[model samples]
Target: MMAGEKNPASCYLDERTFRLCCRLFLQHSETIQDGWSWEQIKGTDEGFMKKTVLIPVQSSVMHKQHGCFMQAENMDHLTDDIQSNVEDETAGVQAVCEIHAVLRYEYHVLYSCSYQIPVLYFRASTLDGNPLSLEEVWSNVHPNYRQRLQQGPWDTLTQQVMCVTS
Candidate 1:
């Protein structure tokens, strides 16, 4: 074995699975234009690395205030009068709000010489430089995938709480 080289017994990731995972991520996020773009970097002795860029997300009126709750004195008379012009007009609110945030997901795929299966390692973070907690990440994931994500045996590297699934 050479320096920086992976052991033959180590389990690594495959190329096809990596590509499929990338496509699935985009499909679920639905905000690809806003971010979630990926780039393939040079391959290392172990395998390949894919980096996903960070994207920002701002809070909306609905998110802040939840929803409007109106009480009418008369059900019959209020029905006709409820058609008043009510503009949410979040321009001013958005200007002063500090709830702006960004999201990014990265993938590292390696080929395991022993197991001979592809191993995928991924990490997600915010633009503020704060790494996301497992719960926070889990909440954003689609329900169908949440169960699998939680059950999967993931290896977390130092400073990065990544989830690795075979």
Candidate 2:
């Protein structure tokens, strides 16, 4: 691109422009080692976003996943020895927030030929690389996005990820 040339303003972004934008952003970030990387569609010039981020899971949430919780007094010693440090709940206990595990999010941004728009797609997994299903992903969506996803784009982002996959 020439110095006088401007960034593409249209919805359909060419691969060259996409590469340029990625380079610009990566250069700005100045991180030689980063989670964001480029991936080709194999035997084609088409490319898309791929980013992985680690998110901390609170002990409370992990606890809920492990089993049901009753009154603190009724709580047993529970030899499970989970991430929680709330040893004594007999007299109304307080617990510090602890990270049970770190979740890895694989994100993607691709131009959809069918929808004629850029679509977002992402999935979360454990550090061990166990991919979470779409149902698991939807179950954890924030309430705010629940309303927004009823419309297009967002609904397509998570569900219609066929933009690139298909």
TM-scores for all candidates: the values are 0.39, 0.49
Maximum-lDDT candidate: 2
lDDT of 1 by residue, 1-166 (tens): 8899988645454556656665777666556432344444567423343445433332321133222222233333332222121122132323222333335555655445566575567777653345666655665566787677667526323235447699
With candidate 1 superimposed using the best TM-score fit, by how many Å does residue 71's alpha carbon deviate from the native?
25
Question: Which 10-residue span in candidate 1 carries the lowest summed lDDT?
Answer: 80-89
**All models: lDDT?**
0.46, 0.52
Q: Candidate 1 — what's its lDDT?
A: 0.46
Best by TM-score: 2
Per-model RMSD to reference: 13.7, 11.2
After aligning candidate 1 to the native by TM-score, how far in Å is the CA of 14 from where it should be?
Answer: 9.6
| Residue-wise C-alpha lDDT for candidate 2, range 45-150, written one tens digit per residue | 8888777655444334334443323334322332222213222222221221122344456788777666556567777865555555565555556778866775
Q: Taking the candidates one at a time, how many backbone clashes does each contain?
A: 10, 0
